[model samples]
Target chain A: MKTQKIIDLLDEFLGGERIKRTRREQAVLDLLDKLERKERKLLEKLAEPHDADEIRQLNLKLQVNRAHQEKARQALESWAKTGEAEKSDDGVAI
Target chain B: MPACWKSGHCLATAAAILAGAALVSAAAFDAAFARIAAGAAIFLFGMRFMEDGFAALTGGTLEHLLKRFTTGTLRSLLFGIVTTTLTQSSGLVSVVTISFLSAGLIDLAAGVGIVFGANIGTTTGAWLIAAFGLKVDIAAWAMPMLALGVILVMHPARGARGLGNILAGFGFLFLGISFMKDGFEAFHQAVDLSAVTAHGLSADLLFALLGVVATVVMQSSHATLLLLLAALASGQIGFEGALAVAVGANIGSTATAVIGSLGANIDGKRLAFAHLLFNTVTGGAVLAMLGPAERVVEALSAFIGIVDPTLKLALFHTLFNGLGVALLAPASSRIAALLIRLLPTPQAPGLTPRFLTPAAEAFPEALNQALRLELIRLYDNAVEIMAHGLHLHRRILFGAEPLESVVERNRDVVAIDLDSQYVERVESLSAAIVGAISRADAKPAEQAEILRTFQDACLDIVTAVKETKHLRPNLTLYVHHANADIRIPYNAMRLAVGNGLRAIDQLRKEPAEHRDTLELEALRVRFEQDDREMSGKIEAMIRDGRITPRMGMSLMNDLRYTRSIVRALAGIGRALFGEADATHGAAERVLGLSDDDISRLARGPS
Candidate 1:
């Protein structure tokens, strides 16, 4: 209740209210989670390929999965090595 | 005049005589009437400039505040009071609330609460005038303020100009009060208004009527209260008569809100009606209990301390408005429901603009926000049509079910007239949005750019719908084809589009902090690869004689259309849900993956 009162006071006086950017890293985390899930889903679909046509579709989807996963992994590595990557590249991290 | 009403010449002659008589009376009391008239004019003018200046300075800050704070009825009531007291114009608060209502930003209950609080908030103006305006030689202050205001008004910064206008507004208000006080004192010397003051209930009712008329003509309760203060200060009107007039002024202020609602939506109308209901009921109840109310006021004044009559009048204003809020606030929800039942939303056509209203257009911030929300509404409609054209149930498409099974289950083409639906739903709304944007006066360059982006989103949505129309026939024919080769690819296309729709829908629902438009951009890159792979596969099939060239050609064309549809949908998503902050959005755009980068990642683990 005390915290809420402080927030309300700030909100009243603050001219342009915006969501805080303290949680900017959350976008990277969410994307990593989503990419992992997509990779798993693609692997499951490719687990029992019946024909070349089906294999090709699975291959293309796997390629997409790998492309995104690789980008997200690189982003995660850069964030861990130096937080500068996260600060500078919102779109790339995601 | 009554006898001559039927004949034009007689009416004209009667009007001339009445005009002459009024001129003679005005000449007799010219000093008093002229001062009063000039003062009222200046006050109203200052109020207008101040409202405009605040609006210009705040931009969309007020809208954001309203959205963030008005979470409940009580909160909204407090918000209305604070904003109105700070701005010194209940009309500004009322108009902003109505605009929010028309834009569907705040609900009717919250709006009713705000209007209730505004009534109480507006009483603070009377207190300011009574406590300070009557005591000071405010015209002395007006000169310096007006001089400084003119200098700042010439400044290029909007903030400076806003401050200048506010300063000038206070100056003019003080000067107007000074003029009014002088006018009433001089008028009292020439003519004894006390001799005309009648006693009893009839006189009270008559004074209340006079108050209502004065407020209605000026469209400002504060002005009416000031006029009453001047009269009472100079013994032009009795204390009892001033109280009745204050009650009437409260009721009359609702007329401004009603006039503002004329261009608003049903919800705006409901809010306006709620304002009228609260004031009228409070006014009527106060009228019935005027005798007891006066005694209570006198006792409260005595208990507080010995007070001047003007200060006592200010207390009465606050007390009565507070009484109204106490009486109506608890019943605000009931009043909202009653308003809703009284003003049912008209059954609009499928393509009618929900968020676009003339009232919203009056405020540029409201206009831009309304147009964006309307575009979102249009996108929702387009999504429905596109889902149907793909023979997918929107309920299933947007549900938690896997799209692979969902697409297979919805293979049988639903009977739908794509052309008619597109024209009626998508095309008409798209046209309306474009027309509104074109007709809108984009004064701020930032608003113009935002509007242009919305215009682009509209085009992308329309393109997606058109591509769906083109892809539907081949999709419906080949999804269940006997040939495994053709049928499997067709199903792949269907699954791809369904997955795209679901991703964009989820992105739309994702919280701001978690949302990432780069994902959509990445999807666009993936769709490009899919188009290439499909083209190559179709070419190989045709060369191998697994499928006829005609079949291969149809598959190629449909594949291209499917890719177009996906790309268009992704474009719409990126435009709508991009980073809200301009700097952050620019960084995001710059950091977005280009086609070559996607290719390098897709080729291998390197």
Candidate 2:
């Protein structure tokens, strides 16, 4: 069978939800994954003793990753409940 | 001569000379002249098709081949010979050399070595024509080749089309040689060229000049050589005169390199000059020893069993070019150093456009490459200006020392006229880039997108420079302020911008294959975090009586400008370095966060 036909059959088997996730939602999930990994890494690094400056920058990066993680989680929840893409309020694509 | 040629009127001069020749030829000998002209046209067209076909077939392997193989003088020389022998066009090799040199892929020494090798490599065409084109009924082969070529030309595959074009090109080239041979034979029966042609060195000199004009007009030394070979085979020209014409053709071939380098940087110009120098010196040496050279060619031809005069002419071509390379190859490094000394990069008041040239603008892909190169130049200049404005040295900013230490050490204000610097360094180049973009031809949808991204990047760089200018005055004023609270935030702002610059610099330096857009996007998030922290610090300082209301207001405004500068730099970086690969670019666009996304994220679950 053709790849598209196979994908269609799979989608049908999965109740049409498998391939229907918006790219934005998937992207947000990817971003959340990266942020969470970064947060864990930062926590591990912070566990070791270091100078005050390195500690401060690491903490700042950790806080930023957590903040983005929180927003991505919220966006993911909204998408799940509404089945509609959550739009960025500013509409600026990086 | 190069200066006059680069003044942009050489094309007009060449065209006028060609027009005069055409008028005189037509007025003097009409039908035979038409045959020769048509033959030359077909030959040149064949070369064009072949060049285009090879370019398409090779895609980018030619560049990689040139880059990989052109390591030393001997290697570069061999690469030039092998590639030109395969392509049958020294001009194509020269243009590729210039393009790579302009892009800084290969150094000038390698470029000169390649040029030297190409001189000998181009001689193979003459040999091919003499051995096959003159000895046999080549037009018989041309007919079948053309039929097969047309069949393959209709194929949908690019490789098939490229192969088709190569076959068709050979067919046309063979046909053109046959036509020219027949035309010259008919003309020889009507009137003897030997009778009218001057004798001795004067005749040789005149024929050599004719060779130069023909090659320049046709823009193909192979065409000129094929015509000379046909004339020689038809008894329309003597062997010595034909040798002179070959010498002239070698010299005239440098015109292609000259034109190619017009769009290149100084190293490219140096390479073009080296090409001209090699050909001219060799031509001059050959002419000065024409009698001895002819005797040597004859002796070499007899030894090699080349009984035909056309074959002898081909031997003469190879011998002379080989002689040139043998004499010049050893000194390739010294010649490159000399060229560097002779043509130092001009110290213009402002950074000029290096890659935006009329030659580059002729093709969409070249124009896009040129624009990207020029935009990178603009980005570099803007970075320099912005670094100076922030009272920091670029070397220190882009160094290994911690950003906090770098900012702390570079506390003393550096005096600079930001407006003048902007105008001199950034504005002129920006204007040139915008003008080149506007003048660029309408492109395909994908290329049009690249141009748009380039345009946005240009704007981002200019805006970043302007923001640096706006933030400079207050930075220089209050960076060393008495109040620690005010000074610390300002220092923190410097550290932020510096860290962003350093990170982008590292990313830019990384190879394209290893580039990570996700990392850059994460850096964007990190920058947002820094900006928010600055905002919070300013608010707290104002409320806790650490800083006055006016100071806090100033702090807020400068914080905004700092954020703008940082964002602009990151945007420029992403536009230039982040989109290196299509897959990565698409993924970055899809997954990258926006300002609003970051803002909402900063609100902690809201």
Candidate 3:
């Protein structure tokens, strides 16, 4: 009976501890999960290049992705250099 | 004498009296004209000589001071009064005021105050004539004053020579008035000239019209009024006729400002309109209340214990102007607004653009204010040019930019038809400003720095055009890389240009007590630091294998050119504020940084 009471208490504690995320937060989590899945697929495709045409197509896609990443890196770099990242949401910097 | 012929005899007697009065009136009118002509000649000559002399003596310093200090309305009014008083010609003051307005040196309100003050200052001439010439027997001192004047003219000192010329002019003015007065007296004694029996209002209007025509012809109200005074003194014309002529003279004097503002900017036109408004309004008001005005003059003369009729006329002139000023003082702004509304038009083009005229340079107080506006323009232009460079560079770097075919064709079409004309206009304006500064008595350092800054700006524009010229064919890897590095130099140029512009504006606008040379020095330091950083970055990219040596060299050249451009801009601020030494020290420091050190610094972190 005491063990059963402890299990009930633990269940209540676990339920209380479970995160109650807002809709926006849940959407962000879902997007991350999708991105992780896409990243895995892209890695698989990159490993299994068949013909020259396919390789070329994959290379182009990779180039586009890399360019996007570089842009993000550059934005962060500039922000770090200028200390202007704090005001990014406001679209003004000093 | 016969009883039956009594009616016929009364008619003949009345006709004879009328005929005599007509003859007298004609003679009086002729005498008045002659006296006026003589006085006008003397007045114009005296005024011309005195204006030139004052200008020479002051060496533009007084004008510079006036421009520098008269930023506000009250100060401007006082400046106008003081300057006109010193120069002894309200017309001269008005011309200078118009020039200032044309040059974009002063605003509308300040310009109005100066005009008001000029009117007050002009009264000094009449007072001098009335008080010293009419009141005191100046004959005794005239010869001595003339002799001293000649002696001073021959003196070694230029300033003394100018003063001597002014004194000599004054002597000549008094001498001429005396001669004219004598001529009138002789004419009066020789002929019975009186128009009192004629229809009063008709005669008054005729004389008033004559006064207007005479003053317009001579271009001097003083001369016209002096003639009226001579006519009154000679008993050729009654007080009513003389008063009407005086009123007309006021209207006619405004023609000078109108003529002076012919090709001036909007500000000049506004000023001319203000003068017209003041004179017309005052003259009309006084004429409407002529009866009351005459009584007031008589009462003022009685109160002042002035028994002479000519003295009464002079007192009347003084009282009228004083009362007009008193009434108009509070209404000046409203009057100015109305005048501006009446003559609303853009300033005439190809005439100093109202932004670069020497009007502000004429007064020392307004000079800095004018300079501040100019610096703002310079800053804004630099910012715009830097922004364009950034946009172009970014497009070239990220995008697969098309070759120059269609784009070049379009640019060519725009350039040939529209852009060329606009560019030419700006170029001409810049050239004119340079020419004006060169001709002016500006400090050498200031002149050199401004010219250099303008040249650098022009060169930057040329460089941008040159780079964009062969758009498609020159899309080499090297070219793309060069475009990417353009940002470093462009940003450095922006920092330097902004700092320089701000420094100049602050130097000009800040109060004397708040101005600090160290502040300017610090700005120069920051500009140099940015320039050094840009140079180091280009070198570091090469050292780190991110860029080829050729690419680094090209980037270095651009960075060097940009640094030089920034240095020139800073030089302008330094020149204006008399801080050339600080710029020189900065140049030396930049030179001291070795190539090896610069390369190592450019490498950033290990």
- Candidate 3 residue spans exceeding 4 A from truth: A1-94, B1-64, B67-75, B78-88, B132-199, B345-525, B528-606
> What tens digits encode model 2's per-residue C-alpha lDDT throughout B1-606?
133332324433543554455467778867566566555555445544554455344423343465568878899999899978876768767866764554334678999999899988888888888888932355687788788888888898766876788778667766765555554555333332344356599988888887887676556777678778878888878888888888988888888778656645577789989999999999999998999999998888788787999889888899889989999999999999999899986544777889999999888767877887898888888888888788788988998898878888676445345665687788889988888878876543345666667788899899888988878756765666667788887888887778777878998889875554444444455556667777878778888999989889988888888778777776777778875533234334544457886565445444
Native-interface RMSD of candidate 3: 22.0
After TM-score superposition, what is the CA distance of residue B73 in candidate 1 from its true location, in Å? 2.8
- 2 or 3, greater by lDDT: 2
Q: Interface RMSD (Å), each candidate?
A: 4.7, 4.7, 22.0
How do the residues A18-54 of candidate 1 rate in per-residue lDDT, one tens digit apiece?
2222233345455557657777876888888568756
Q: Against the hidden reference, what TM-scores do the models get?
A: 0.44, 0.44, 0.41
In the range B89-125, model 1's lDDT, one tens digit per residue, is 6765786677555434467889999999898888899
lDDT of 1 at B334: 90
lDDT of each: 0.71, 0.72, 0.51
In model 1, which runs have C-alpha deviations exceeding 4 angstroms? Answer: A1-94, B1-63, B135-196, B349-606
| Predicted complexes: DockQ each | 0.04, 0.05, 0.01
